[model samples]
Target: MDLDVFVAAHQAEWARLEQLLGRGRRLTGAEADELVALYQRTATHLSLVQSSTPDPMLTGRLTQLVARARATVTGTRRSGWRDAARFFTSGFPAAVYLTRRWWIPTALISTAVGVLVGWWIATHPEIQNAIGAPEDLKAMTKPGGGYETYYSSHPAASFAAQVWTNNAQAAAICLVLGGFLGLPVLYILWQNMLNLGVGIGLMSSADRLDVFLGLILPHGLLELTAVFVAAGTGLRLGWTVIDPGHRTRRVALAEQGRAALGMAIGLAAVLFLSGLIEGFVTPSGLPTWARITIGVAAEAAFLLYVYVLGGRAARAGDVGDVERADQTATLPTAA
Candidate 1:
C-alpha cells in the first residue's frame, strides 16, 4: 500500500471536514448531516492510517483534525442534572432489571445463609461462648445494650455519612473486582452475611431478636438488596470474561463492565437512602412496625422501578451502557 496515494485520495475529504468544522455556530440540516458522515469517515481514516502508516506527523495531524471535528459535531454535552435524571429514570433501573436473574437468586441464597447461621448461633450456646464471653454477649444483647445503642452512638448526620461512605465502598469493590473470577465478590458477600448471622444469633439467643429486627429491617432491606445487586452483577461480569458467548471476550467485558459501573453509581444513591433510614428512622422513637414498614416501602419502590422502568427500557433495547457516541472504542488493528 502506498501511503502517499492513500493520503492524496483522502485529503479532499479531510479538507471538507475542516471547512464544516470552521463554519458558524449553528449548522444547516444538510451541513449537520454532512458533518456526521465526515466525522465517521475521518475517524475510520485515522484508524487506518494509525495501523498502516509510518508517518508520525501525518498521524498526529489526522488525530487533531478528528478530535476537533468530534467537538464541533457533538457540541457540549447536556448538563449533569440531565444525566442524573436519565440514569435513574432509565439507565440505572434497566441495568438492575437486566441482571435480575443473577441478583434475585443471590438475595435468596444470601438470606438463607444468614438465617441458617443465625439459627446455628441461637441454638448453640457453645457457639455463642466461642464467639465471646457470656458477659460480653450479655452486654451486647441486653435491652438498651450494644446492639440497640450502636445506631445512636454518633450524631445522626455523621452516622449517615459514615454508613453511606462504607456501603458505597463495599458496592464499588464488588463491581470493580468482579473480573477476578468473582471470588472477591463472593468473599465480601460471605463475610457480610456471616457478620449478620452472628449478630442475629447472639441477639436471638438473648431474646432481643425482636429489637434487632426492628432496628435492622428498616434499613437492611434496601441496603442488602443494593449489595446483592452489586455482587451479582460483578459475578456476571466475571462469568462473561470466562465465557463471552458469541461476542469476543473483550466486547462482552466492556458491555458488562459498563453496566456494572452504572449500577455502582445508582447503588450509591440507594445506599444513601438506606443510610438516612438507618440513622434517622431506624433509631427513631417510631413504633417497630412503622420503621419496618418504611423499609419495606423503600425496597418495594426500588423493585418496582427496576421491573417497570428498567424492564421497559431494556425490552426496548437499552443495555445501560453509556450512549454510543460517548463510548470510547479501540479501532480494530486490521480494519
Candidate 2:
C-alpha cells in the first residue's frame, strides 16, 4: 500500500473533522451528521493503517483524532448524585459480594492467627513478662486500664473522625497496594492481627478477658469486616496477575482493579459507621450484651445487604465498574 497516496486521500476529511471538533460549540445539524460519518471512517482508517503501515506519528495523530471524534459523536456524559446512589445501592455491594470467597477465608484465617498468638502469649508467662514489667502489665490490665480508657480518651467527635480516617486509610492501602502480588496485603493483615493478639493475650493473662471482649466487640466486628473486605478485594486483584482466566491479563486486571477501587469507597463508608460505634457505643454505659447486640445487628445488616442487594445487582449485570461507554475503547484483536 502507498502510504502517501492513502494519506492524501484522507487528509481533507481528517482536516474537516478536526475543524468541526475545534469549533467548541454545538454543531449545526449537517455538521453533526458529517462528524459522525467522519468518525466511523477514521476509526476504520486507523485499523487499516495500523495493520498495513507502521508510521507512529501518523497513527498517533489518527488515534487521537478518532478518539475525539468518537466522543463528540457519542456525546459526553457527566455523572451526578444519581450515579453515586446507584453505586452505593448496587455496584459497591455487588463487588463485595462477588469477592466473598476471598474475604471470608481471609477473615477466618486472620482471626485464627490472632487467637493463636493470644493463646501463646496468655499461656506463656515468660512472653508476657517480656512484653512488659509485671507492674506495668497490671496497670494496663486493671479494671479501668489502658484498653478501656483508650476508647474514651479523646472527645467523641474528634475520636470518631480520627478512627475513621485511620481505618479508611488502612483499607485504601490494602486495595491499592494489592496490585504488587499481595505481599503488602499479607503484611498488613499480620500487623493488625498481631496488635489484636497482644491485647487479648495481656487481658486474658490478667484475668480480664471479659473486659477486653466488651471493649472490642462493639466496634471490632464491623471494623474488622471492612478491613477484610478491602484486603480480599486487593488479593483478588493481585490474583488476576497470576490467573486471568479467559481474559487477557491486562483486561482482567483492569476489571478487578476497578472493582477493588469501588470497594475502597464503599469500605470507607463502612469504616465510618464502625468508627462511630467505636467512639460512642464501645465506651458508653450500655451493658455488654446490649453493646455486643448492636454490633451484631450492624454486622448482620451489612451481610444481608451484600447477599440480597448485591446478588440482585450482579444478576442484573452491575460489576462495580464504570459504565461501558465510560471505559476506553479497545481495538479488536485477532482471536
Instruction: For candidate 1, give the lDDT of residue 257.
Output: 91
Model 1 misplaced stretches (Cα beyond 4 Å): 1-38, 46-65, 329-335
Q: In TM-score terms, which candidate is top? A: 2
Clashing pairs in 2: none
Candidate 2: 10-residue stretch with minimal lDDT: 326-335
Model 2 C-alpha lDDT per residue in residues 64-107, reported as the tens digit of each score:
99889877887788889999999999999999888999999999
Evaluate all candidate structures by whole-model CA lDDT and list the values in order: 0.91, 0.91
lDDT of 2 at 255: 82
Query: Per-residue error at 115 for model 1, in Å?
Result: 1.3
TM-score of each: 0.84, 0.92
